[model samples]
Target: MLGPDPRTTLVWALLLDWLGQLLILALIVWIPPALDWSIGGTQLAGQYPWILFCVLLYPLLGWLFGSYTVLHWRRLPMLVLIQRLLLTAAATLAAVAIARWLINPGEEVWLVYRRVQVVWLVSLSGWSLLVRLGLRQGMLLPDTPRLLLLAGDEERDRVLQAWRRVPQRERLRPIQPQQLEAELSRLDVAMVLTLSPKIHRDPALRSVFQHLETADPRWIRVVSPERLFEAMQERLPPALLAEQGLNYDDLPWAVTFSIQAQLKRAADFLVAALLLLLTSPLIALAALLIWWDDRGPIFYVQERSGWLGRPFTVLKLRTMAVQSPGSPATWTQLGDRRITRVGGWLRRVRLDELPQLLNVLNGEMSLIGPRPERPELEEELEQHIPHYRKRHWMRPGLSGWAQVCAPYASSIEDSDLKLSYDLYYLRHFSTWLDLMILFRTIKTVLKAGGR
Candidate 1:
């Protein structure tokens, strides 16, 4: 059982969500006038632009809040999903209220009535979650892309298991080689997937490819499981990459050498310099709290492995009590006794990393990339995890693709999962991707979405 292409599902979900929310807003604005409710003598059309802005704003904020992401809706707990949707709506409302204050402060202009505000927020939240539920049940997109698996039994089972790990398997139909042409003839066969290159050996299937030049070929997209994972998850797993006879180094290694690297460096320096200026007061307050809590050193500096396995001294606000000499430092666990109360807050809101702006300025790290690991642990992790050393292929980051997408990694398995996302970022680092990481990082700070 395989679901439709991730790109297809994600696009459809976002478009539908925006359209549905737009309808909800339209009804709310129009119904007020129909009920003879006074709206500052402005016609409903006055609110049309506002409505369009909000409808667009929800999904944009939704992206930051992880309301809409790869696969959009599947296997996530419904409670967490609803919480994200409500958070997105609440943030959008706050933004709108701020705009209203600046635009026409302290007045019920353009659907700003307190009563209508409540209805608007509740209605949007309800409709957002309702759209998610519809996507979850596959009721919204009825015309799902159908997949046909072209492989032997063992290969077919491998493909099935891989899709199952994405946890979106229910539509992959495995057929005998003899049936390839018949399956291709079906209009619903949106993707033809195979695990082996020998698929062309079948003379019948061969004829289909030969005649595909004349037939409508766009309907039959050919992809392998590895390519499918790369497209769907946007990450190249070490094993899958190797299985395709590709080395990790064979990747388009553009992370540090491309023009994006030069642009990233300039952006990092300017942004970091400005952020250090703007955030200095906040950092001072945090440092005072750390010192007041336990009269300990206010900063922690450690040498961490960096770009291409070089080492750099990373600086961070001390989030744990200073230990005596020869004390074995350990990974900080949730609710660790070593963490002070203020330290826990700093970690939750990610203030502990503020000092790294200096590192970003110095070019030891990036504003977005794979996170650097402590040198003491980096070597061991490289031994245990496949392609783990690839993390040093580019500069580390203050907040990163791994930090945003993956849970805090405390074990080997967790490290592998994080490295997958990091590799994806390294492979596709660009301005837009950096902006996305920045947006999600902001969301994380707002929600204290991490430990």
Candidate 2:
């Protein structure tokens, strides 16, 4: 059992998935033609060739959605892949249905082949599942050694203990701080994972890189111990990277801000538009519900701090009972008396903010940025948190880097750390990075990260 190579495994999985889809498509497309039997009386129509085009799409979708990443196969992640398979199957069904409707629309075909359409969907879903499962299982056979070094002894021991509890401990070897230099020389290790910040700063340990270069370069395996564990990771942005010895303030701020902001806003407009379109029905339904509740305005607009301390009215469906009472801006509590039943659900799933799409469209917000806060909260926060106002340097977002990384911000400390992530997004904005944040936000919304 050879352990799967993370880099090459994705490529191979995609190829294999494509091959399986092609074979299944061929069988569906050709077998019907060969049989000369009308599939539910569609008469083996001219539209059968379109199945090839639809089949080619599934593999790319699967790869993009991470339906094929199984290099770190574990029970929970395997279950996640299975769920992705179900979604992929659903998407496949929708795509095929759309294709048929658009390109294969003949009343005779619809009338004759209604039942066969169901069969085709079932078969395609089954085929996709088989490929996904086969690829997942193929990775379970350990062929290569995955030696993960826990650089910090205390942190490493904790992880080592956890892995040992997993019955498959044979696949992992935890290297303590002292043994790191000696182990790197042996050179056949597939992964050298480090998760200890303490280990990263050690001058003696850093010198091991020189020794490793002297050894077999093919034995190249450098795992960021920092990436190996979540607790060890800092959420700081580049501007406040003084602790990490990085200084964004020293660099060209105007060029950096202009380019990054342009990319971020472009992404914001594209994503916000797509999301508004995709969820239009839901937004409509929510709007109707909100109006029915109080016969008041469905969309609530509140003044919130925006880029560079600019004030903007952030949009939301009125979730609170009072239009204006108590403080002008306050955080909604876990069980607030002001919340309606619908409001509670909205807060839970974060649907209340759907109207923010309008804000995004109006250029007041980005789809992904720092969450806009009340001016009152901003003034208070800036006093305590270092560089807290730095978050306002970019437009506030509907969903943000901090919202995905940290759980719902309730306390000042949580908000402060979240500000760090917001600054990070402003500094490192890109289309690809926005996609990553969107993916992370989905997981956060699903509560899949377990907070």
TM-score of each: 0.78, 0.65
Model 1, 310-338: lDDT tens digits are 98898999988788876754666667898
Instruction: Give the winner by TM-score.
Output: 1
Given candidate 1, what's the lDDT at residue 48?
Answer: 63
C-alpha lDDT score of every prediction, in listed order: 0.73, 0.62
lDDT (Cα, tens digit) per residue for candidate 2, span 265-324: 776688788989998898788888877887777777788888788898877877778555
Taking all chains together, the TM-score of candidate 1 against the true structure is: 0.78
Candidate 1 residue spans exceeding 4 A from truth: 1-35, 43-71, 76-110, 126-189, 192-220, 243-257
Give per-residue lDDT, candidate 2, residue 156: 67
Winning model by lDDT: 1
lDDT of 1: 0.73
What's the lDDT for candidate 2? 0.62
